[model samples]
Target: MTHSLDPAALDQLFLQARTFNKFTAEPVGDDLLRQLYDLYKWGPTSMNTQPGRVVFVRTEEGKQKLKPALMPNNVDKTMAAPVVAIVALDTAFYEHMPTQFPANPAARDLFASNAGLSTDTATRNSSLQGAYLIMAARALGLAAGPMSGFNPTMVNEAFFPDGRWKANFLINLGWGDPSGNRPRGPRLAFEDGVVLA
Candidate 1:
C-alpha cells in the first residue's frame, strides 16, 4: 500500500533538485554509495534483467584515468567531484537471468539467442537505471551531475579494458557547491510534451 509523498519529498526529488556543477570538499564514501545503489536497484527492468553496472571513481588515480576521456568542458568538474560513477551496460547481462528471473529459466536463451535484442535491452534498461540513480542521490541529500560530454571509446579503453562492460554515461556525485550552478532553464508545459488518453 502506498500514498503520495509529501511536498517536501517531491521537492527534494524533482522540483528543487539541480544538476550540480561543482562540489565542496566533502567526500562521498563507499557506505553511502552502497545505500544509493540499494535504493535504485529495484527500479524495474525488462524481465528484471537489471543490466546496470556502476563503477564509482573516487580516488585521485581513478580521476586521472578518467581525465583524458572527458571533453574539455567536462574535465574540471569531473576531476573535482568526490566520486564519478561510471554507469555502464553489461552486454552479457542475460547470463544472470537464470538466477535473477528464475520463474522462466528459458529467459536467458530468449535474449542470448538474439544479439540485436540483447543490445537494445541493455542500452534502454541501463539508461533507465541511470536515471533512477540520480533521483536516488537527490533523495539522499546528495547533488548529482549527470553528463554526456565524454568520449565513449576512450572511456571504454580506460575503464572497461576487457570489453565485457561498456560505459554509457558518467555522473559526478558529491555535496554541490551552489555557486557553480548555472541559472535554471525553462521546461515545456505538460500539455506540450505529453498526450492524454
Candidate 2:
C-alpha cells in the first residue's frame, strides 16, 4: 500500500521551499548532480518522452559563457551560485521514443509527421521535467532558483550551437542563504486559478 508523504516532506518539497537568490559557498559536486537527474527522470511525461536536457554550469568559464545571455537582474546571483543548470528541450525527442516508449513504436511516426505536435510535446514535457528537477533538488536538501530572464537566442548560441536542443530556462542550484531571500510572496487561492469540471 502506498502512503502519502509526511507534512515535513511536503513542506520541504513545496510549502516551505523558496526560490533562493543567494546561496552559501558550498560547492555542488558532480555526484550530486548525477543523483539529482536520477531522481527527477522518473517523473511521468506524455509517452514517456523525456525531452529535458541539462547543462550544469559550474566552472567560472561556464558562468562567463552564460553571462551575456542573462538579464541584468539575474546575472550577479547566477554567477555567485555554485551551479547553474541550463534546462533545455531536444527538438528531435521523438527519435528516442522507439526506445523509451517501445510499447507503441508508432508514436514516433505520429510525432515526426507533424512538426507542430512535436514542438508542443517537447516544450510541455520538458518544462514539466524542469519542475521535477527543482523538486528533486529540494528533496535532496538543496535549494533551487529557476529563472527565465535570459535571452534564449544567446543561450542557444553559447550552449547549444549544434541546434538540436533549445533553451527553456535556467535553475541555479545550491545551499540557500536565508539572509538574502526576500519575504515570501503570496500565492493564488485554489479557486482563483483552478477550474473543476
Poorest stretch of ten by lDDT in candidate 2? 1-10
| Tens digit per residue, CA lDDT, model 1, 21-76 | 99999989899999999999989999999999999999999999999999999999
Clashing pairs in 1: none
Least well predicted 10-residue stretch by lDDT in candidate 1 = 1-10
CA deviation > 4 Å runs, candidate 1: none
RMSD, each candidate, Å?
0.8, 0.9
Candidate 2 regions with alpha-carbon error over 4 angstroms: none
- Candidate 1 whole-model C-alpha lDDT, 0 to 1: 0.95
List per-prediction Cα lDDT, in the order shown: 0.95, 0.96
